[model samples]
Target: MPVVFRFFSVFPLWLLHVMGAAMGWVVFAVSPVYRKRLVENARRAGYRFGEVRAAVGHAGRMVAELPRLWLGAPLPSRMTGEACVEQAYAAGRGIVFLTPHQGCFELSAQVAARRWSAARGPITVLYRPARQAWLASVMETARNRPGMLAVPTTLSGVRQMIKALRRGEAVGLLPDQVPPDGQGVWSPFFGRDAYTMTLAVRLAQQTGAAVVLARCERLPWGRGFVTHFEPLPVPLDERLESAVLQINQAMEHLIRQCPQQYLWGYARYKQPRAEAAAGVTE
Candidate 1:
């Protein structure tokens, strides 16, 4: 399958984007809920229906650009880390890069570890491992590129992240992702309460690391992704929930900046479990 994707990567960008539009529609057909939610969420956020449609189309293009990101563009060649990393190092602590589920998230990390040429410590990304063994294998190989490490969404992985921070390395996590019960807190996202991962805030407090936002913006014609950085709005307080909400707002701010690239198909608002549903953090 990877070989097949490699072959497809050689195709023209315009053609690939067209194919991706069709592919996205196919997926949309199977998941009406996602399609409806995408529209509804955008509208609720004050995005026009026509604007949403255009953004959705750009999303298809972003999907097609995925293969290009991995096989065609090298991290060092594509991504640029700004004062973000330098600021992180000045703290003399580990860095926690909070990336949204927008535009080539995988590229942002690879570029930092392999390209930017910074004296960054260990770069750890927190991700939910694929359930299917075969598909999981492909994902592992594609993301586990040079100079980057994968931390599974487990207690073991959590420990590894803590260790990395203590060593003054950098760790990354997608706070927008839904976490298992007991691992998340209900926070406001797009004006709706979402079960957001609190680990990002906890890590910041535990390690005294500076929290920063990193996003990969897709360039036109599949040329490459431009990496942008922002400081998180959260304070360095010990309370997890307050800090978590601050980060969630930052993510929403970024989403508004590029509404078209944000992943609206995601089930952002769902019934919570006994822990999260009851607003229990500990």
Candidate 2:
């Protein structure tokens, strides 16, 4: 599998994206579960199929582009709203970068880590480890490059992020990623109750880190990505529930900017596991 990825990594990104789009459509047509979830999730967000259909191909591109991003040569990227990050860093407080499941999310942290972490401090990114041993090993090596540190979605991982933030370093997380029951709270996402991680809000509140909404938009035909970083629309409240809702609202705004590239097929509304659910309060 690594050899195959390496082989594909050498291909032109545009070609990879084109091939990925075809693969995406094939899956959408053949898998009822995927299709249903994609459509339902989009609909819940008040988007018609016509508006989000492009997301199917974008999701595939997300997968296909990983090899080039992880193991292949570096690709060119530009940033907008970069001043937001600079200002935050200059303040001497840590930064909390909250990116939704939109566009080239993987690229966002890499870009920031390279651009800022060296002068500022390292960015600890939250990610769930792959179940397969081979994949997990590959990911650990790939993610722990220069200024970036990838931590698993475990108790210790959360502690690591908090420690980073307290030390005036950055931390990145997908606030929209459903956390294991006790780790998240039921919050309104797209007018539906989705399990939302409170870590982003908690980190900021505890350490006074500047909260920013960021994403990397995949330009057409794989030209490259344009990363955007902006401040949260509203300040996070002291209350946990209010803070989580604010985080969700910020995520909703970001996703709206690039509905086409958002991962609409995620099981956003799935019920929490019974064991874990018992620990999470409604």
Candidate 3:
């Protein structure tokens, strides 16, 4: 199975795109709940239904590009977009990238990794290990690339990421990931209590890393993406809930800029993790 995934990863980028697009459409057709969620999120973001449809279509483009993301697509060289981490890196202040499930997230990482690789600074991206054992092998093989380190959402992984930042390297994470028991706090996102990961805030506070919101916006047609960077105010306090709210607010600002790319299907407001309480039912 890992071999099959590797083979697919090596396939021509165009073929991978096609398969991703097909998979996305299948989801849109068969999953009414997903579409509904997307609609609700769009509304929360102040986008009308017509705009949400357009956003969903743009998400389809992101889906098409997903395969390339896992397959090590070469980073864009002429990154005409303004990804502003260079300034922070120059100051010897490590960067903590707070990204939402919006736009071409993979592209954002790929572009950052490529751009900063030459500077001898690496980027660590936080990720959750796949729940399915088989998918774990597939994901690990696909994500570990030069200049980019995949940090799992575990205590050990958190330590690894902090160590990297202390060395003046950038560490990234999707603050939206639902953390396990004792690892998250319920915070208001889009007017609802969503279980939010505290890792992003904690990392920034611990390392005094420059907190920034980064994203990849898809251009019309096959023109490619524009990754942007902006400084985000870090609430560097031991109090986690306040920090989580700030992170969400920052990400929400970015998502508003490109509503179409924001992923709406995620159960952002799901109840807090009950990992310990719901033990081994299956």
lDDT (Cα, tens digit) per residue for candidate 1, span 51-71: 856556666776776666556
Model 3: per-residue Cα lDDT over 1-282, one tens digit each: 555555555555455545655676678778999878877867776778787565555556665554456764563433543445767788888888777888778777777888786584678887777889988866676567878888676666778888888888988888876777666778878777778877677777778788878888766545566888888854455676777888878888888887767887677776666563211111
Instruction: Give the clashing residue pairs of candidate 3, or none.
Output: 55-260
Query: What would the C-alpha RMSD of candidate 3 be, to one decimal place?
Result: 4.4
Tens digits of lDDT, candidate 2, 1-282: 778877988988999899889888989999999999999999999999999899999988888888888878877799999998888888888999999989889889999998998788889998888988877887887788889999987667878888898888999998888777676789999999998877787789888999989989999987999999999987889999999999989999999998999999988888755333212111
All models: lDDT? 0.73, 0.87, 0.72
- Candidates sorted by TM-score, best first: 2, 1, 3
What are the per-model numbers of colliding residue pairs? 0, 0, 1
Top-lDDT structure, candidate number? 2
Cand. 2 TM to true fold: 0.95
TM-score against truth, every candidate: 0.87, 0.95, 0.86
Name the regions of candidate 2 deviating beyond 4 angstroms: 274-282
| All candidates in order of lDDT, best leading | 2, 1, 3
The residue pairs in collision within model 1 are none
Of the two candidates 1 and 3, the one with more favorable TM-score, higher being better, is 1
